[model samples]
Target: MSQSKITPKSYKVLAVDDNEDITELLEYTLSKEGYQVKTTWDGSTAIQLAQSFLPDLILLDISMPIMDGIEAGRLLRQIPALDYTFLIYLTARVEEYAEVAAFDIGADDYLIKPIKPRALVSRLKALLRDKNELAYSSTEFRIGDLKIDSLSYTINYQNKVLQLPKKEFELLYFLVQHQDTVYTREQLLSHVWGAGMHITPRTIDVHIRKIRERTGFDYIKTVKGIGYKFTTEPENT
Candidate 1:
């Protein structure tokens, strides 16, 4: 998993390229960093891999046989279930159209083909760093009695531990890290799911319920027309 490589935690990465050499290079490069990576030449299998891997990031090639990267990306984005997968594209040097298309379809970044293995690794590390930073910039937050580690993804309450599923953990981490900030379903979907994933806005509600049930954060407030907020400090009545 991508997370495992960088943070000693489970994180997965999916790399797609019709060229065996390119796929192999990416897998080798990323794996050297202790990242768990999966790669394939088949674009049709992209969605299936996504569902199974729940990758932290996907590096997709723009051109391929059978199914193209654009189509694969569109399909992934249309699922309305995977809300947290980041996407980057590998394009030929002359493929300007593919670059534009990659961004239009929701790719966060793009790299020219015949990639420098070292450079690719560097970019991935930088991307992950920014992601972690943006997701957990807060100093501290308490949702009810639950205490969350902004950097570690560890949670505790009243000296008791609370375990969470992969997606659930990420969602709760985001909410508590940004306590007191009201976030709409779409915003949460975008940030948590990533631009590469297609997810319904209402999925937040389900995760919210799951979060409330699993932890002591019974005080998570709903804004009705908007979304939810977890306030560490109680409101003055």
Candidate 2:
């Protein structure tokens, strides 16, 4: 609520962090970039704010009391008002291990902290630009018993909606793009995450596990030690 920067043209950014100082920094920095910024000191209020405003993107902090950024992001994705909003994890922890788990929880991008004001602005702008483009692209695709509505950001299996985390939905979307064609973890990471990050092969394993828990993991085929492929439709699962 404390203002130090001029609001952006008209974009809304929900900045959530348990640390008041960090949320203030994000609000100050992003507002200067012309974004209408709102701040929450906890994930609970972050979800409320998101439910009300439905921001174009969320700047989420990884470490927080109660519900963490991962849980917050997951909850926000379920809110119909904020379902399609992009989520970026803002954190001081950039170690390889945490980074993988962060993405597995469904962050579009993870930014290492001590972030320069201008650099952060640039990244936000780029993310917004790309997201806007993808939004208008075809959002619905159907294959056998698997169906995805891109705009809704929801997936259905045999007409029964499947509860998948953001990353799981994205991974499935990518694999379905080339059905029956196996893609390596390296390939999956590159295509899904882009070359902007350095991540491990195990990242794929974690998400695949979560995916299986919700809808049985075997549908996503693992080539022993290689990559994964979307092998069977629900009818085939």
Top candidate on lDDT is 2
Question: Per-residue lDDT for 58-94 in model 1, tens only?
Answer: 8888778889998898777665455556677777844
TM-score of 2: 0.75
Candidate 2 clash pair list:
8-34, 8-35, 139-150, 212-217
The runs of at least 3 residues in candidate 1 whose Cα sits more than 4 Å from the true structure, single-residue gaps closed, are 1-9, 138-237
Per-residue lDDT of candidate 2, residues 1-237 (tens digit): 742332246688888888888878888887777788889877888988888887888988878887877787777766766655778888888677777767666667778887678877877776666545445565677776778876556778767886565556777788877878888988887877666645676778887777777765356777776677876543233
- Ten-residue stretch with the least lDDT total in model 2: 1-10
- How much is the lDDT of residue 56 in candidate 1? 87
